[model samples]
Target: MTRSFSWWAALGRTLLCLVFLQSLLGKMGGFGAVAAQMQQRGLPIPAVVLAVSMALMAVGSVLVISGWRQRLGAALLLVFLVPATLVFHTALEDPQERIQLFKNLAIMGGLLLVIDREAPSDRPVRR
Candidate 1:
C-alpha cells in the first residue's frame, strides 16, 4: 500500500474504534453507576458483565487500531454491540433511541467489513 493509503486506513480503523474507546474511558470513571444501570436493566451479574464489556471494548479497540488481529477485534466489538444495542437502545418510541439503534447498526456493518477483509483463512499459513 502507498504511504497515504496506509495512513488513511489506520485513521479509519482508529475512527471505527473511537466510540468504544470513549465509552471504556467513561465507564472507567463511573464503574459503579454503569454497573448499577446494567443491573436495573435486568442483566445478571451486572458488575461482571460490565467488566467483560469494558475489557472487550479496550482489547478490541487495541487490536483493531494496531491491525494485528482485525477480524478478532471486530468480532469482539460485534459481540458487545449486539446485546448492548438490544438492551440499551431498544426504546424505539424515543427518537434518540432510534437514532442510536441505527448508528449501532452502521457500526456493526463496518465491523463486519473489517472481519471479512481481514479473514485469516484467506491468507497463507505461516510455518
Candidate 2:
C-alpha cells in the first residue's frame, strides 16, 4: 500500500479501535449501573440480563478493536444495539438520551463500513 493510504487506514482503524475499546470497557464496568437503570425503566427480566448484554457488547467490542472476526462482530453488535436503541432510547421521550443512542448507531455505521471494506476472514488483527 502507498504511504498515504497506509496512514489513512491506520488513522481510521485507530479511531474505530478507540470507539470499540470505550464501548467494551464501559459496558463491562457499567453493567450494574446500567442494569439498575434498566430495572428502573421496567425491564421484564431481572437485572442479570444486563450482564448478558454486557458480555455481548464486550465480545463485539473486542472483535472490532482487534479487527478480528469483523463480520461476526458487526452482526452481534447490531443485534445488541438494535434492542438497546429501541427499548431504552426510542422508548424514551427525551431528546438528549435519544441523541446518545443515535451516536451509537453512528459508530455502528462506521464499524459496518469498515467491515464491508475488508474481507471478514482475510487477515487477523496485526496487534
Candidate 3:
C-alpha cells in the first residue's frame, strides 16, 4: 500500500476503535454502575453480561487497531452494539435517545465498512 493509503487506513481504524476504548475505560471505572444499568434494562445475568461486553470491547479495539483479525473485531463490536442500541437508545420518544440511536447506527456502518474491506491475506497477487 502507498503511504497515503496506509496513513488514512490507520487513522480510520483508530477513530473507529476510539468509542470502544473510551467506553471500556468508563465501564472499568464504574463496573457496578454499568451492571446496574444492565439490570435496569431487564437483562439477565447483568454482571456476566457486563464482563463479557467489556472483554469484547477491549479485545475488539486491540484487534482493529493492530489490523489483525479486524473483521472479527468489527463483528464483536456489532455483537455488542446491536443489543446496546436496542436496550439503551431505543426510546424514540426522546430526542436525545433518538440521536444516540442514530449515532450507534453510524458507528455500526463504519464497522461494516471495516468488516467488508479486504485483509492483506485476502488480497490476490497482482503480478
Clash totals in order: 0, 0, 0
Residue-level lDDT of model 3, residues 6-117, one tens digit each, is: 8788889999999999999999999999899899889999999999999889988898888878889999999999988988998999999999999999999999998999
Per-residue alpha-carbon lDDT of model 2 for 7-126, expressed as tens digits? Answer: 565566567657546766776777677777888888867466776666676777667655557567667777777777777776346788878788878977876786687553555768
Q: Rank all candidate structures by their lDDT, best first, as comma-separated numbers.
A: 1, 3, 2
Candidate 3, 36: how far from true, in Å?
1.0
Cα-based RMSD of the predictions, in order? 4.2, 6.2, 2.6
Root mean square deviation (Cα) for candidate 1: 4.2
Residue range 28-88, candidate 1, lDDT tens digits: 9999999999999999999999999999999999999998888899999999999999999
Candidate 1, position 68, lDDT: 82
TM-score of 2: 0.68
Predictions in order: lDDT = 0.91, 0.69, 0.90
Off by over 4 Å in 1: 1-5, 118-127
TM-score of structure candidate 1: 0.89
